[model samples]
Target: MFDRLFFVLGETFTALRRNLGLAFAATGTVAASLYLLGGLFLAYSGISRYADGLSGRFEMRVFLKDGITVPQIKWTAEKIRSFEGVRQVNWIPRDKAWEKYSKENPEIARGLENPFPDSFKVILSDLKKGDEVSERIAKLPATDPDGGVQYLRDEQNLIAQAKDALKVLGGMVGGLLATIAAVLIFNAIRLTVLSRRIEIRIMKLVGASYATVYTPFLLEGAIQGALGGLVAAGLLALTHRTIGEALKSFSALSQLPSLPYNDLTLALSGAGAFYGVVCSAAALYRLQLRYR
Candidate 1:
């Protein structure tokens, strides 16, 4: 049994070497694809924590009209924050709003005067009392003195926007890259099957079982996939250590924790291995029909 395993492994290596160019090509594709996917996964994991925090932190937004006094806004915020279930209140001055807007839309911000209004973000201990809290805020004389108080109807929109942004980016570019990688792997296996038709036919004639005939090829694919995944994982680790650290310094991004190294590596490696096995089995099945 040991000898057969060794023989199969040796043959797998031999096959890889024989098709060294295609093997390397497929490996590179797999590495790039897996790296992109793994990076997305880790990024989403980190961002989800931030998302949860943001969701918890911004249950309500109270927008003040233009020309509202800073003192008045602060007083109003304090009054609302003192209401039942209210935990925290933050004042967003027009300048701060302008700064945030410029950061988000630099092109559109050019030469534009700060027309943004003052606002307050309210976080509550019990979100179910949001309506009651809003009504209490409206009664405060310091809030929206010139007009009726404008309350944000849905605070969940911010979290929803954050989630949608990530999805849009992933679906467009990531989907394309993954498709390219899959096609590259599929072609590599197809080429291998074509190259080994005579050897496979000989084995079949010699009464080799299906597993005996195809096991080496299957393992070859798996080995390549695993190697590619490992390479991607290494790059991911480097990125997290360097660039990810820098991103954490920003106040908005500071909430995201660093990616867990070992878990991400294992996940990527497993995904890569599964990708290889499925593609190899498909290729082999096609060849088997042809040869039979």
Candidate 2:
């Protein structure tokens, strides 16, 4: 049994070697397909992660009512921290806020003469609860001293809208890539079937079982797919490294983390090989039936 298996493998290898040029061409095509698909997946993963990080930093800045004392500000911050969804409350002093603004926009800093209002920067466990937190903060007595705080959850709707828009855009991009991959693989396998029509017919005429003749072509397809996957993975890794180095020079991009090379490679390779084998089997089956 082992010897028979070896013989089948040997035959497949021989056939592949005999058509070295075609095999190389097919491998290149597979590699190119994999590279594009892998790149898209990697970008999707990276962007999704960055968006999550941004979401985690999404906090509500509650401006205090004018003329509030430091003790009242501290009391208000404590109250905010006690809210159900509140994870943390950071009291941004007027001076610190001014400093932050100055650092962020030097031109605006130079013109600023009036001090900005003090605020309680509330970080919530779930951003969706921004409205609830805002309502509670607004009811504080500091807004009227007697009773009537008027804080607004200004960033909540904007954050929710951005997240929804990004989700839709990501899905559309992924779907488009998937469609392109399907079309490319279909054409590749169709060409492979057409090119092997006569060879498959003679095997059927010799009374070969369907499995016996079809398995080798299926195996070849798998091998081709694996080759493509490896090449694509390697290219992706190289591209990622190159891009990361270039991005490091830019202060804004320096903080953004690139995808881990190993994980991305494994995912791309696995998906590429699976696509190859399935397309190969379908192509051979249809071609063999037509020839018979």
Candidate 3:
């Protein structure tokens, strides 16, 4: 068993050495494809995490008409509280709202009348029900007729749409690159098989098993793919570190979550290896070898 393993390894290395240029081309293609895919994965993960955090903190603001009385505001709050999925409702008087605005933007507040309206900050237990709650609140008598209800659901929807577009675009590009890489691997293995045709026929005539004859080519493809995966992993790690460092200069983005390096590496490597094996198998399948 050990002898056969060593023999397979020897033949694999020999084939790789003979087809060094093709092997390198295939490996590089695989690396580039996997790198792009990995980048997309990381971006999708980060954005999803950020979106989830934003969703958790999402709140709806319902503005009341200018002439609304204190009693009317209290009544609106009670009605909102009775809505399903309503978690907590907080009332913000017009004066308090104006004060906050003035403190946050002193320049804008200069010589400006307190144009703020009385509002209720509505917190919901389930963010998915934001539109439903907003619809219900908008129909209230106290709600401002012109854009009384405001929530981050629209912004969240935009984010979700962006994520979907990105996924589709990335999948297309990655899939194209992966197909090119597979073709390169197939050609590399085919060339090696062609070069060793005589030897293969002799082995077949001598009762060599299919596994014994084909294992070396399969191993060669796998090695190339694995090397590519390692290269892509290294590139991703460097990119993550660079981006992390750059984000530190901006306080808002500094809290972004880091990429899962170990998981990505494993996934990339395993995927590359599996892809290579499949391509190699396909190449061998198409070949016609005869030993008489």
Candidate 4:
């Protein structure tokens, strides 16, 4: 079995050398497909991380009605902290608000009366549940005697919905791209097999087992796929580096997480090798059916 495997490997290599153009074409196609996929994955990862970071800073300010004492404030804080998904309840005093506002807007600080209200800054574990937190906060016993606790960012729902929609759309687009690439790959492999029918038939007539004849084609596809993945990985790395250089001054993009060199290399290399192997196997299987 070991000798047979070596023989098949040598045959596959020879075939690849003989049909170098076709092999290169297959590799190029696979590389392009994998590159697009890797880019999408990279973008998704960055966006996901960004969203998570933003969610961590998500907080709802609950203002107290007039005449509320420290006891009432403590009660309200305890209730909020006990609620589901409530990570932490920070009580921002009017003084701290004034200080922060003054520091942020020093010009307006001069004549501005302490318009800051005593507010309970409630932080939630899940940003998606912001609306739930706001609703629960408003119903707090001492939230507001006359009026309710007003949400500063009432548009959070709209933003969350938008992000969810974009995620679904991205998934759909990725699936479509993958399907198209697979069909193209399958057809390309079939054509390659058809062109080699005479040689394959001769081998079978000379008593070569189906497995023996099958190995070389499978190996060829595997090789092409691997080469393609490698090319795509290189291209993606270069593209990212160039973009990083250009956007080095942009603080936001600079802070975004990117794939480390080792991870990217390994993933792309494995993907390429796997694609080559699978494409070769599939093509060989289909071609063998016709001969049998």
Candidate 1, residue 154: lDDT: 69
Worst 10 residues of 4 by lDDT: 145-154
Worst lDDT 10-window in candidate 1: 144-153
Per-residue C-alpha lDDT of model 4 across residues 1-292, encoded as one tens digit per residue: 8898888888778777767776776677677767777776776666556656655455666888766788989998999898887788888888899999999999989887898668887776666777777788888777874545554354556556656765675577655654554555555566656766777778878888877777777677777777777788888888788777778788666444565767787788687777667655665566555446
Candidate 1 C-alpha lDDT tens digits along 1-292: 8987886777688788878998898888888888887777677666666645654555676777667786778778778877997788888787989999999999999999997778777776654466688787766765565544444446544545655676776776677876776676677777776787787778778877667678887887787788788889999988878886787688575633666768877877877878887778877776664435
User: Which candidate gets the maximum lDDT versus the true structure?
Assistant: 3
Candidate 2, residue 30: Cα displacement in angstroms equals 4.2
Global Cα lDDT for candidate 1: 0.74
> Across residues 96-195, which tens digit of lDDT does each residue of candidate 3 receive?
9999999999999999999999999988775557788889999999999899998888776677777897799789999999999999999999999988
- For model 2, where is the 10-residue window of minimal lDDT? 143-152
Clashes of each: 0, 0, 0, 6
Of 2 and 3, the candidate ahead on TM-score is: 3
- Model 2 quality (TM-score): 0.63
Q: lDDT per residue, candidate 2, 99-136, as tens digits?
A: 88899888978976647777776776766677787688
List where candidate 2 sits over 4 angstroms from the true fold.
14-30, 55-58, 66-87, 90-118, 124-202, 205-207, 255-258, 288-292
Report model 4's TM-score to 2 decimal places.
0.78
RMSD values, in order shown: 10.0, 6.4, 4.5, 3.7
Which residue ranges in model 1 land beyond 4 Å of their true spot? 56-159, 245-256, 289-291
